[model samples]
Target: MADITHRRVRTNGIWMHIAEKGDGPLALLIHGFPEIWSTWKHQIHRLAEHGYRVVAPDMRGYGDSDCPADPASYTILHLVGDLVGLIDALGQDQAYVVGHDWGAEVAWHLCLLRPDKVKALVNLSVPYRPRSPQSKPVEYMAEKFGDGFYITQFQEPGRAEKSFAKYDCLTVLKKFLLVNGPDLLAAPRGIEIIDFLETPDSWPSWTTEEELQYKAEKFRSSGFTGALNYYRAMDRNWELLGPWQGAKITVPTKLITGDKDVGFQSFGTKSYIESEFLKGLVPGLQVLVIDGHHFIQQERAELVSAEILSFFGKRSGN
Candidate 1:
């Protein structure tokens, strides 16, 4: 076991609980929606052993962090600013950043908006989707692919949050962690697994019962509202990025996704992601495909950690 310490720092008017280990070459890890600092448990010890300072924070609304009632506070710009504030609070000028899901979206924006604060970036699952200058989100999706069911569902005001809040929120979150196809045939309840069923390749190796219980307990610690606020900020984030629409990120960047990640096939974004998003990157950029689902860090922690360590090692040396 690594020497781990839990601490809190004030950022963006809220206190964020962060877990830190090791002491050289700072590597800041950010977890996505429905997850807390514990999500990076596997990577924290391993990365620290490899001579990197690992800092994982309960991003604003989850875990022991302060949960702001205002939905607007969860916007991408605010999230990015929160991370910048975190770095300042830590007294570091810049650090290599790694994020998954919503965290990845914020990491990408952080690199673009505060390039001086990010030495390198590793984003899992979600790829960089550049906003167009005069394109309405609906029109943009229609031009690239039709419907965009996920975004549409998320943009449906309070529908998703309310539904999940009413239903078994923990179960819904567990279904997403399934890297393979839905176990619908075995599950007692016949609820259809959405993202996991659609993109089986993105699923990571199955987590142990202990691990699953740990994550489930965390979700129960705080109701779904804080996590769901991330979804509620879609339009707000869109408006926030209006000024930086079409701006390319010029930094050391790497995008990692599961081969069966539903996000790639999501609304025909695979082609657009490869052709447009990846191509728009101005500096060092690379895409990696791993055998896992959206939560690759939790499922395939060794592989994810190795890839990130290699990327940061080479970049830091240069």
Candidate 2:
């Protein structure tokens, strides 16, 4: 493994911490909620060895990155701004971007809003979704999945934080990362989402105790408010992104996900991915489904690394 280095850079009016290794054409790795830059441990080293500089950041509101107090600050515009600034700070005009979960959503918006900043995108977990002109995202989610849905439940400020405070950070991390199945995250009316999530019987085989502890410690220090703010800003993002309705991400892209991912299983995503509809939204799209769960990057680290390298190799001429 190459020596990984850590540093902070000023971007979009805040200091963002990043973990990076190797050196070549830039490969920016973005992690989702309940995780930090270390989430890409497997890919960073692998890509670096194959002549790519891999930079993974602990996105705003997670890990050592600055956590803005206002939920309003967590909008997709803010996220894309941070990433755009990050690319500039690194002295690169564009980068190969990879994202998972919330990070994937951000990556999609990054490519949509500013195609010039991304060389190519390899997004896992979440797929590209066009802005809906009919209704706000939170309202649609509430009507479709009800208020008990995790995103709907996360709307209220401090509510999910209070529920999460009931347990230690490690336990909170375990519940979010380890649990599986489609629609399994929905809480019953009057129940907290944290309590509703079934705890895993054992630790996942892919990650080590040290890694989980490092993440747990970061969450313990930062609190979950910054991360939860991403959910709270869903409606706000919908309102702001109205001008971009029906926009297609023209960047060359690939989506690799676990066959059993909750996002893949629920909300008619499987059908949508299989349908011609997705190709229309992401015209440069390529899809691959693997036998794993939501945390496919870590759960199937070697395979994920190889797949990313292969896709990037073709584009980067490595």
Candidate 3:
């Protein structure tokens, strides 16, 4: 692994800490919620070795980045703008953008908002879901799957945050990383990991002691407020993106989802995403299914990097 240098870049009224390595065509990598720039550790060195400048940032509230108090500050548009500003700060006109989870949401918005700033896009775990004019996020979820219990929990301001704080964020993190289909099915009323965090001893064997500690310690540095804020900005993001609801993204786009990941199956949006989101909204888009869960980038780093490199290389004619 190559040494990663850390630098602070000012964006969206906060100083974001970015880890960068190598030098070739610039590649901007953004990490999702509960993860910092370190999430791209494996890819940074690998991409750098493959002759690309890899830059990964701890967005807004993660790692060494500044955490703002207001939840509205964490809106998707704001997050995406911070990334665009980071690119300007680095003096790059545009770069190949790759992101996972919430980072994927930002990447999608960036491509939609400013196509010139993005050479190509690689999104993992989360697919592009265009907002409908008549549908509220909660209502949309409920219409499809009766009740969106997860989004409902997040709608509560401090409930999930308090639960994560109580468990020291380890219990929820462990369950998120390791829970399988059988465990999910065995639970009677849908397994809410936040509810289970109240008792850490009941945490399953999916994550080892060391892995749990690593995540817990990272959250300890800033607590769960910053991460939770991302969820809190749903309404604000919808408001900001009202003008872009029906916009079609023209950039080269690649969507990667983990096969076993519950996100695709959540409210049964997998087929909807393929038929509606990608094919319907974005033009010239490709989808890739990998074997894993939500944290596919971390679980399958080399494969993810290869896919990203291949997509960007082909687009760049390299």
Give me the candidate number with maximum lDDT: 2
lDDT of 1 by residue, 1-318 (tens): 357899889998889889999878788999986677877888788778777788999897888888886778888877887899999998899989999988898898898899999988998988887765565564454345433344444444465565455546456666555635412212122232232233233323445656656667766776656777776776666777888866789879998887666676543555755674467664457888877666788777889988988888832331
Residues 265-306, model 3: lDDT tens digits: 653546866684468688878988878777777778779888
Q: What lDDT score is found at residue 23 in candidate 2?
A: 84
What RMSD does model 3 have?
Answer: 3.7
Residue pairs clashing, model 2: none
Q: Comparing candidate 1 with candidate 2, which one achieves the higher lDDT?
A: 2
The lDDT of each candidate is 0.73, 0.89, 0.76
Give candidate 2's total backbone clashes.
0
**Worst window of 10 by summed lDDT in candidate 2:** 309-318
Q: lDDT at 49 for candidate 1?
A: 76
Candidate 2 local lDDT, residue 166: 93
Identify the runs in model 1 with alpha carbons over 4 angstroms from their true place: 136-151, 155-158, 182-205, 314-318
Query: Order of candidates by TM-score, top first?
Result: 2, 3, 1
- Rate residue 100 of model 3 by lDDT: 90
lDDT of 2 by residue, 1-318 (tens): 259999999999999999999888999999998899999998888888788988999999999999999999999999999999999999999999999999999999999999999988999988877878888888988898776788988998988898899999998998898877766578888787889897787877987778888999999988999999999999899989989888788999999988898888876677787778889988969999999889999999999988988888832434
Total backbone clashes of candidate 1, pairs 3 or more residues apart or in separate chains: 9
